[model samples]
Target chain A: MEALGVNLPFLLVQIVNLIIVYTVITKWIVGPIMGLLEKRRETISKGLEDARVAAEARANAEKEAAKIIADAQAEASKVVREATERAESAGKDVRAAAEAEAAKAREAAMAEAELERNRILGDLRGQVAALAIAAANKLVGEALDEKKQRALIDEFFSGVKSGKVVVVGESLSGDAAEVTSALPLTSEEQDVVKKNISAKEYAFKVDPSIMGGLVIKVGDKVLDASVAGKLEGLRSTLK
Target chain B: MKRVWARWVVLAAIILGLFLFTGFFGIGLGIKPIMPHVYLPGEKLSETPLFGIAGLYPTNTLVGLLLADIVVILIAIGVSRGVKSGKTVLTGISGAVEALLEMLHGITEGTAGKWTKQIFPWFATITLLVLAANWSGLIPGNETVGLIHHYDHGYDLKQVGPITTIWDEGTDDGEHHGEYAIVPFLRPVSTDLNFTFALAIVAVVMIQVFGFRSQGLGYLTKFWNTKTLFSKPIFGVIDFGVGILELVSEISKVLSFAFRLFGNMFAGAVLLFVIGSLVPVFAQSMFYLLEFFIGLIQAIVFGMLTMVFMSQATQGHGEHHEEAH
Candidate 1:
């Protein structure tokens, strides 16, 4: 053992040295290194967690942006639809007003034409009376009275004489009566016809198709006093 | 291309100069390499005691211990400073030491589990000390440049410029002219039996400390298993015998640990010496590399074995647990 150098003194020195070295290594080396390693690991995991949170936040922001954009688009389209509807309704109102104005204008033009036709018919009635008086003078070989001839012509065309409807038949009582004449009636003639009809309401009209006399309608009854009706009666008696 | 040629030229000249200085072809002082004398004990440098203690003085292995201590201290300082500065990664030597110890720590965690905190320091320290001591031997002038003393059968000394080396004086008419030998001032501490024995004793003592720590006084039952002795008469003798054998094996473990490191390191040193004396030049470099690998393996093996034994001590023996159930 001595030859191999295992003396107590050397062995003691080495053991003490080992203990000292162990302390140095444990305190100054191992402890700090392990702590550093653990800290590094923790830092890395925290950074990863932060990155993950950032990514999640970014994703949520993108989704919210998309939602807001979609809502804006929907609102914009709704505004466009409402504006289009208002424009169309305004166009329809303008068209309806234009149609009403055109209708009123057309009605006024027809009333004026009716009034001109009535005046022309009144002038033609005077010419027809003069021509008749001339023809009677040639036939009788003497001139007739002018006032009597005028009166007779007026009564024949107007279908009224002395403020009374000469076409009145029996006692006709109804809710309304319509009097037709070959020429437009004067207001006094319409009033005479209304009184003779013994109805609540009266409508006067001119129809040249009646030829000369009046055709009075009371309820469903008709008093055909036209010259065409007299001619049809005479023809039937001759046959 | 010209610079590359010049570099090769300088390198060849250096090799040729080495061959000439080492007396390759018996020219230029004709230095002959004498096979170094292998000593088991660390050779004392002086007759005087270093601390006035009888039979205790400064020796070559003690010098090697100091060099190894310096290396370990330097490593410790580098690591602590690097870690203290709050660097995420250590650089240079401290980085290398950290990487090596971290690997050892991983192994300790795998082996010892929860006791790794308590166990890894011993593993780290023992491996570092042994590794430093073993590698310090490989330095030039270690076990080579030393004191010359008179001996019965030894080599003559030669001086080549400022350096002194031993060379064999060839026989002249069947007579020897050399009567002196070189005693190196530094030998690796791993090659010393005292260091190896001390480490082994400490490791074994720690093993028992862990055993008692883990199991209290029940650890003694591993070597004195009497629980099964009275329970089963037929197997009682066998159990007692096995317990006694466990005690014997525990004693042998210390010897095994000590001699295993010392024998491998000592033989490696001897092999390098024999190879140097025989080939004298480039051949020793190859063995030096070989010894480098061997030294690292022996250091790790010593520490690893200690760790394994210590870890084993922390757990109850299987038969004891089985018998308890």
Candidate 2:
């Protein structure tokens, strides 16, 4: 060992020096660097986690917003559909009501026209009878009274109400008959017409434009015999 | 294939050119031819009385050891200062120190496990000190520049002048030319057995301390297993004999560790001297590189050995053997 210069004091000193270096390096250098690296890594990971959470929240919020918009759209469409259906139904009801009212007004106007035509026809017949009486007086030297004229017109209407005017004989077995005339038929005349027609059900109408005609309709058949009807028939025969 | 051959040709040409230049052109340029200077272990430049004491003197190796310590301490101080400055990232020399310490931590931790934190200091110290001491010789003036002493036909202590004036020329160049040898003020620290042995002793002592700490008094059973003797007589004798061998191995560890560092560093120094003498110029550079790696390897080997021994010592003999298997 002496040949190798193994001195105790110097070895001790070297050992001491080494220990000192190790202590300083460990305490001052390694400790701080390790800590810094660990801290930086942790901070980075935490930031990443926070970013991920924020992105997830954003996605969730977007989904919720989309759902609300979709829900609102569905609700709005449902409301519009209901409103459109309600408006269309109301228009249909109004159309139906208007058609019915127009039909009723047309029927009333027709009834009034028939009444006026019947009055006019009655006046013309009275005039024609007066003229005929005057001419007869001139020819035979006599005057016709009002009571006799009324009896002649009533006799003519009785023949039509009893269905005797019908050219083609028809079976009168139906439960109902339709009666049409130029003048309004009174309740007594309607009963007489019903008794003569021998039908329990009856429909009566007046159209003065027909010129003193009585038309009877039962099922698909019709009988017409009046002054206007005979004149149309003579005209058609002349043509 | 053509490109690869071209690259190889270029590499070969460069190598040949380097060899030719160092062999022929280098010498022709008047580079001085250096003679290998012979040196003995513990040779000193000069001896000075310790604190002016008449008979007490400090050896030159002691001065070298002190120089190594001062350098290491200054580095430690510099590193400490860098750390104290509170910089987030180490740079330059402090960075190197931190890297070295970090590497040491990896090595020691692998062997020592939990006790790495406790034993890493000693391991770092030995490695750094040995590495620094070994590398110190590569510097320009180490073991080269110092005072010169002149002696006549026969040299004697009484024939020399006062300690301070040892460099002074006492006699002129006359009929008899006295031979002289240089005594450098500083030598590489690892070349001194005293420094290496001191570090080894410290390392071995710490191993025992760790062993005691880990296994308590039971650690001594590795050196002497008295309980095994009565239980199994035949196996007990073998166990007892093995214990004695273990004790001798422990003592031998210090000597071997010391000599291992001393031998490598001392041989590296001689190699540098011989190479420097033979071609005094560019030739020494390659050897310097070799010495550099040698220094690094020796430092690693010494430190790792200490760590391994400390780790092994901490475990009981049976457990250590089992682990070895």
Candidate 3:
């Protein structure tokens, strides 16, 4: 044991030294290390918690932004829809007003055109009556009676014979009467036609297209004794 | 290019070292490497005891112990101060100590459970102290530079540039210079039986303390188990015998623990020098690496065994003993 250096005092010294080392280690090394570990664990957990909070906050922010954007889009669409409706309504009103104005102008133009045609046809009737009178004077080798020839031409053009409308066979009564003649009727001819058809109002029109006849309309009934109507009847009978 | 210059520099250094140490081609100091005398015990530094008492003289192992202690304490201070300064992590030696201790703490917690707080300090202390002592041996001049004393089986001393070294004359003829031996100033304390036995004794005592602390007076029943001695026939006698054997094993634990660390570290130190003397150059570097690994392993093993025994003592004796069987 002496050769191995296991003397009593040195062994004792080492034991005492061991105790001191144990004290130093426990107080300094182990205690601080444990505390540091615990603190590190705390720091890590706190970091994770902060990150979680930030993430949640970011998610909330994103949701709110999405909601705001949706609201803005909805408002924009609503504004756009309202603007479109207003524009369409404004366009519809302008179109309707324009159509009404066009219709009124067309009606005025038609009335003026009818008056002009009737005046022209009236002038043509006078010339045709004069020509017929001269031809009658030649055919008979003598001058025909002037008043009688004038009456004959008036009867042929107005479809009125001896101051009575030949087209009105039966007595007619109505709220209004419309008379269409081949030429513009003189006042005397209009008074004769009105006397045949009883109505509240009278309208006189001349058309050369009807040849030498008169057409009368009282309410819904019409009396057709125009030359053109006679020719259409002959054609149907032939077919 | 940088790496290439470094290699050339290393090659130059190796040649220079060879020339200086070996005196190759009759240049430089003539080589006279003396094999150091192997001593089992730590040689005393002086004839008079430091404490002014017989057998209380200072020894080279005592110097080694102080060096190891200073290293451990300095590291402890650095780690504590680093942790105290609110740093969760440390660097350098403090970092290394923290890493090692933290690993040890994890192991202790896994094994010792609640008793980890009580048991882990001893584990740390022993590992650090033994580790420091073992590694200190690897320092270049630890077993070489010392006080020369006259002896029958020694070498002649030579003075070169204010340094004294052991010299061997080439011829066997009696020379003008005398023979002498060296008592190295520093030796690894782990090679001392006193330190190992002291550590072992403390560890075994702590094991019992944990046993008593955990089980109270019931722990004594493990050594003198009269509870089942007469109740059953064959198994009761066997249990009594086992209890007595457990008492015997406790004493054996001290012997095993002490000698295990001592034998390994002392043998490693001796192996290093023996290999160095046989092939004095870079061959010993390989064995140094070997010694480094062995030192780490032995330190961990010593600490782990103590921790296991302590944790075992803290458990129910009957259950664990049965489990052991």
Q: Which candidate is the best by TM-score?
A: 3
Best by the DockQ measure: 3
Which lDDT tens digits does candidate 1 get at residues A1-239?
Answer: 98788898889888998888888878888888888778878999999999999999999999999999999999999999999999999999998999999999999998898888888987777677788788978998877787887777779887788877677656677887888888877777777777777888887777888788888888998888988787888899999
Q: How well is candidate 3 docked (DockQ)?
A: 0.61
lDDT of 3 at A234: 96
- Chain B alone, TM-score of each model? 0.91, 0.79, 0.92
Per-residue lDDT of candidate 3, residues B1-325 (tens digit): 9999989986786776677668677786647555577787788888888777678778999999999999989988998999878887998999999899989989999999999888888889889888998888888888888888887767777787899877877676745255688889999999989999999999999999989999998898889877666776777789899899999999999999999999998899888888877666667878999999999899999999999999999986776665654
* Ranked by DockQ, top first: 3, 1, 2
lDDT at residue B104 of model 1 (Cα atoms): 90
TM-score, one value per model = 0.69, 0.59, 0.83
Interface RMSD of each: 1.0, 3.9, 0.9
Clashing residue pairs in candidate 2, if any? A7-B194, A11-B198
In candidate 1, the second chain superimposes onto the true chain B with a TM-score of 0.91
Candidate 1 pairs with clashing backbones: none
Expressed as tens digits, the lDDT of each residue in B1-325 for candidate 1 is 9999988986786676467546655655555567777889998889898788887778999999989988988898998899889898999988988888888988998999888889888898899999999999899888888899887777677776887766666666645477888889889999999899989999999999998998899888888978778898868777778879988988898899999999999999999989877766567778999999999899888888889888888977844556565
Chain A of candidate 3 compared with the true chain A, TM-score = 0.72
Preferred candidate (lDDT higher): 1 or 2:
1
Residue range A128-214, candidate 3, lDDT tens digits: 999988998899998867999898888988888888988788988899999988888898888998898899999987777888788
